[model samples]
Target: MSNSDFKGQIVVYSIVGCPFCMRAKQTLRDLELPFLDINLDSYGESVRKEVRERSGRSTVPQIFFNSKHVGGYDDLKALLADKVGLDRLIEEVKNNESPPEAPKVPDSSELKKEKIGDMDFTCELDEHAVLIRDLKMSGIIKDHRKGLTTHKNTFQANQFVDWLVKEKSFDDRATGIVSGQDLLDRGYAAAVKATRDGRFEDNDTLYRLLEHDQNSALNAGLTSECEARPASDLGEDLRKLILSLYNDFLTPDGKSVNYKGIAESSQFKMYTRMTAQLYRVDIKSATREEKIAFFINIYNALVIHGYVAVGAPTNLWQRYKFFNYVSYIIGGQLYSLNDIENGVLRANRKPIGSLSKPFSKSDLRLVVALDQPEPLIHFALVCGAKSCPPIKTYSGKDVMNELKLAAEAFLEGSDGCQVNADKKEVKCSQIFKWYREDFGKNDKDVAVFISNHMGPGEKKTSFLQVISQKDYKVSYMKYNWAINSQ
Candidate 1:
């Protein structure tokens, strides 16, 4: 009934691997409402049946505002039509409201135990097997022996081999503990499988192997040999593997794979793995600029990887095309581009390209070279187009900071974006357009805010200035999304 009455109350019933669920979560976050999430995918059949009986929907994204059935995605959107639905729901919850209780699912541990052997091995095996198969299928692996090794981290090297054996159960190279070449082949295979299935877990495991190996090498006092393991040892093969995987997963016409699904599932794991690897780097061994350069390579690589995977156009001029999609992934998740840039790539006081260039896209680093403060780098990345810097992939360590910076920068930078005053028209950024809950008191607040941003000069102005100005019109600007070209 009152705003104060609904300070923090929201509940979302969702399923993992479901895009709708992710969308719903993003919606709630944009609204700034604290809500609990019930992941049905992790639940048992009995619980799912119970939920179905109560909600009368077998599909996921069953949301409750206060204690009422808010239905699925469409239903949620309907509630959002008035824009006050989220606010009202929060109020209702604060008033001690209870939505009709959906059946509760068991915890993850219980589910994991129950589903361990029952899992569709075909799916699991297919997901895993495909990694190796794709490498062979793509003809990327030249040698079954010698396996690739970036460093002398034997633990990671062993893990890489183990992952291959576990996934493929390939016995030929499984004996004698295999060489770096053999492990390299398996690693590439695993990566390919991950891309094909859109399974981040697999990719995460691979990254973990790299991190573990790096650590093992360091702990063994084998830094020289490990560090000298030549980029050629893994770079060329890795590049090819990543390229192929990206194409298979994201490209629509190539393989008809579900790029979006795979991206969502695997991105979280990828972020985690990458974070570990970056953090594990011997910063003392490498200069600050060198670290930033490494991150730049990773950032650009991921952008290219994501773009290819999504089957989006890759020309430099088409940067705006993928802004919304890129922003959604970066901003909606626990990890983001800014996390990598500021948290791990900490090359402040120096430009991004002041160091060496590992990748061909050396020119792209200039976009991040703007005079804006280090704190503003997140905003710069958010605005980064194909012509701009690649969106840095984030890790768990920097998630909170990344989210905060992204929200603030996006809001502030949006002030300079397209807005029309006269017709009470405002074509603000799609972020405001889509996740209106994130900005306004409801949706109306977003319009008012955009109107203020549209005002000229740096003076305190009234709502009248926003509404009455002749030039005030929201222009629908095309988002640039082309791959960064050097």
Candidate 2:
């Protein structure tokens, strides 16, 4: 598409938590136009103040359609409120036949060498921005155009492969193709996933990918059997008791657990006894999956009890006594917060102070490797902190569904997984960092695992689409260590 045909960029400058900003971007997507969403929160207050001065408004989302101020969400709605006018404009932009004076991109029918990172590979793109083939790279066509330099939306070509291979943590040898529809719907990430499962040859234009083609090789190896929740009463009673605790003391948001109420409850000790009883059942008797669910439940229950037993302290993590000394006997084995988490659940078999890896040898190592290390365990296990997954009652029957929902909720939750479409980067929760190995040894593995669990939504679909189409960066959001309370 030529610049004249393009309606110009939709620039959204807004704060991180601003709902209006989110709505504004969503509206732009609904119109099928690519946008650069500038989150001022990433740069802090000073930058936000600068934006306030430039936009002549104290609040956001300040939106610009073709570099002209269009007020905020309300103003954009007014302009696009006319369906015919907007459609005509988009059609004109898409049909523009004028090409650039000097073609920086190759012709649709010719092959050319593009230097990406350390390798010089033959790559080509069709007239509609669909990548024909890279010959060497796996996922290609991360971007079709860049925003104005004043907008600072352009990424370096050299950093593309480096970020994908080194930081995004993909195996360099991995191969895949972004389907046309996936490239359009999901953006770069979804394209990467599709590419991981896609194939490209000659005559595949970017527009062709956008067309409906069930026969497209892009769908290959993308299908999997849907997992059903397993039925088992292995931890049913404990779940009921945990539910009571959650209903009575835990607020809906799960940020706060009323330790005082828990301590004062006549049945608090009753629930604790129930935990002890559950763990008394021989661990070997339960299936490995049951063990995984039960272990997570028991771990969480003990953590809650630890606080109530000593009066829930607001400044919980500051006290070494809370985590170090607190212990519980589960399945005839003793465990503390650090012990059960790293040594048992993770199979790392080492104390907190000393670094440990999954399956590593240590004195605390359990002989049986039943519940092997799972990345989702990080989301399930509550470490008596504010940022931990919300307190939930998990039974063997619903453990599968429970964990899936927890992950989805955590990821889609506030500041959970922030995707910077402009920069082609994603900021994920710190849980991925602390237990990165559990997900995979590298970024690519983590991305693959996440792509599987991310729920069906416009935002997530768009995020993954971008991921699939090109090289992207991944970083961890800062951890919140405060006690998670209401």
Which candidate number would show the highest TM-score if scored against the true structure?
2
Model 1 residue 299 lDDT score: 48
TM-score of 1: 0.28
Candidate 1 segments whose C-alpha is farther than 4 A from its true place: 1-9, 83-88, 97-110, 113-486
Estimate, for each residue in 203-303, the C-alpha lDDT of model 1 and write its tens digit: 11332222223211111111111112222212222222333333334332121334454455554234322222222232223333333333443444444
Which candidate has the top score in lDDT? 2
| Per-model TM-score versus the true fold | 0.28, 0.48
Model 1 lDDT at residue 207: 24
lDDT of 1 at 258: 49
